[model samples]
Target: MLINKSFANQAGVSLIEILVTTLILGVGLLGVAALQISSLSSNQEGLFASQATAIAEDYASRVRSSKTSTVMPNTNISYAQFVAAYHNGNNAPLACAAAPAQLCRSDAGNAALDCTLAQLAIYDQWEVCSAAQEALPGGLVRVLNNGIRLTIVVDWDSEQGREDIGNVAVRNNNCSPLTGSNTRNCVILELVP
Candidate 1:
């Protein structure tokens, strides 16, 4: 009778053990969830970075293929104009194997103009200027006579109603960075000719 009574008494888990197990399981689950969230956020951020890089490169290529004089300092190539010019092949003489305008054609050679200064490499954002307010993304220019440096900047937040995408210089050699998430991806391109 005593043995049977003792066995019954110890048949189940102790309250402290159960509590510890519950606490451990809860903590582990929370950690896993935090990890998942962080991973997902990182993935999204990577995608954004990729897109920014693509935009920057596209901008660089467009500038490369187009006539440099058209986009020189004090010129007024609006954002729309820039995009249109990029898509339209920049009036470059199409090669024999030229594809349609909608397709991104390659300009392996045949010559192209280089960028000028105000083309700083630091403050990397696209800007355009208007008569009333020059807060656009195309007013910045670099003045380089012997050599030219180019940086392609992407404006991911501009289309989303953000206010921090329009004040980068062409060279950006000396500028302070803003205190927030990065607003641009600057690819440095240099030309000497």
Candidate 2:
């Protein structure tokens, strides 16, 4: 009878253990939530870097294949003329390859200057810049021609939560940040295009 009476008086101990277990479980869940957030942010940063690199290379390839100064029989314009057209930025976007104007056509049937060489350069630029902006955030391209060499700089707005992305060197090389709000990421490529 004495032992039974003592056990019956200890019911409060079970309630205390349940409360402690619940507290520990809640803390563990909170930790997991924080980890998930960090992982997502890191993944976004990686994606931005990859996009910047690919876009820069795409423009480089286009410049190479569409060289203005080819000596082949099919190419009528000189390289100098092509470079000048690109620098002037006068060729507005158009469906040059279509009929009537027929400004751009690489097929064998097309005659010379169907689409002026400058028109081709402008079209290529628009295609590249448009693709970059669509794929990445606040994307911009800067092309510099220094007579002997060409530099292509691809810029995009830096993603938030990336403290290491922007530095003094990036600012020095690129005049503006990727976006107005944060440090801009710069992908610089040097070529003889």
Q: For candidate 2, what is the lDDT?
A: 0.61
At residue 141, candidate 1 shows an lDDT of 22
lDDT of 2 by residue, 1-193 (tens): 3578877777575877899999999999999988886776667666876787887788778777667334234466665665565553322221223233343535477554644555666666666677667776767776666565666666666643244443222332353532233367767788776
RMSD of each: 13.3, 7.1
Residue 96, candidate 1: how far off, in angstroms?
A: 32
lDDT of 2 at 192: 73
**Model 1 Cα lDDT, one tens digit per residue, 121-178:** 1111221101101322211222122213333223233222222332331222221131
List TM-score per model, in order: 0.42, 0.61
Q: What Cα-based lDDT does every candidate model obtain?
A: 0.36, 0.61
Please report the TM-score between candidate 2 and the true structure.
0.61
